[model samples]
Target: MDVVFSDVKGMKEEQEQQISLVAERNNVSKENKFHKDEQRKERMLELFLRTKESILEGWRQW
Candidate 1:
């Protein structure tokens, strides 16, 4: 649980940084790059969260 918690925290921090970078770049003339990157990151985060939930649920079942 602790490990999962720490991982989620780290991932959240990284996601924040990624989003912030995109936000900063938004002022400049960039096409779908930022949007694509954000979508990619979001999808990755969602997968990670789902995997984490599944693992936790499995642990609980044990």
Candidate 2:
């Protein structure tokens, strides 16, 4: 009986550790995704500004 109880305790601890690891991984993934999205937005904004400037310069020359 004691051996069985010890086995159960070990299994429970291992499961908890696995759950914690998964949670940490998920958080890291979310942060990475967010960072990528932010970078994409910044690039888009830069492109928009460059295009706008080009258009304005052409109009000024005309």
Candidate 3:
């Protein structure tokens, strides 16, 4: 009976550790995804501003 209890306790600890690891991994994945989205938005905005500036400069020359 004691051996069975010990085995159960070990299994519970292992499962808890696995759960914590998965949660951490998920958090990191979310952060990475958010970072990538922000970078993409910044790049798109930069492109738009550059295009707008070029068009305005052309009009000014005319």
Candidate 4:
């Protein structure tokens, strides 16, 4: 669980950096690219959270 938590944290940080770079390149703060990137990141975070919950549930069942 610790390993997965670390991996998700790293991924979130990396994605944030990438989103900033994309926004810089596009020369827009509130553009479609930024919105889409944010949405994607949110989805990714959601998935990771769901996975963590599932893992915990499995452990509880065991």
lDDT for each residue of candidate 4 in 24-53, tens digit (9 for 90 to 100): 877765587789999999999999999999
Candidate 1, which ten residues in sequence have the lowest lDDT sum?
24-33
Q: How far is candidate 2 from the true structure (C-alpha RMSD, Å)?
A: 0.6
- Please say which candidate is ahead in TM-score: 1 or 3: 3
Instruction: List candidate 4 segments past 4 Å from native.
Output: 1-30
TM-score attained by model 4? 0.52
What is the total number of backbone clashes in candidate 1? Answer: 0
lDDT of candidates 1 onward, in order: 0.91, 1.00, 1.00, 0.94
lDDT tens digits, residues 1-62, model 2? 99999999999999999999999999999999999999999999999999999999999999
Off by over 4 Å in 3: none
- Cα deviation of 4, candidate 3, in Å: 0.6
Q: Name the runs in model 2 displaced over 4 angstroms.
A: none
For candidate 2, give the lDDT of residue 5.
100
In model 1, state the lDDT of residue 29: 38
lDDT score, candidate 3: 1.00
lDDT by residue (tens digit), candidate 3, 1-62: 99999999999999999999999999999999999999999999999999999999999999
Question: What TM-score would candidate 3 get against the native?
Answer: 0.93
* Candidate 1 lDDT tens digits, 7-55: 9999999999999998878855365677888999999999999999999
TM-scores, one per candidate: 0.51, 0.96, 0.93, 0.52
Residue 27 in model 2: shift from native, Å? 0.3
User: Model 3: how large is the Cα RMSD against the reference?
Assistant: 0.8
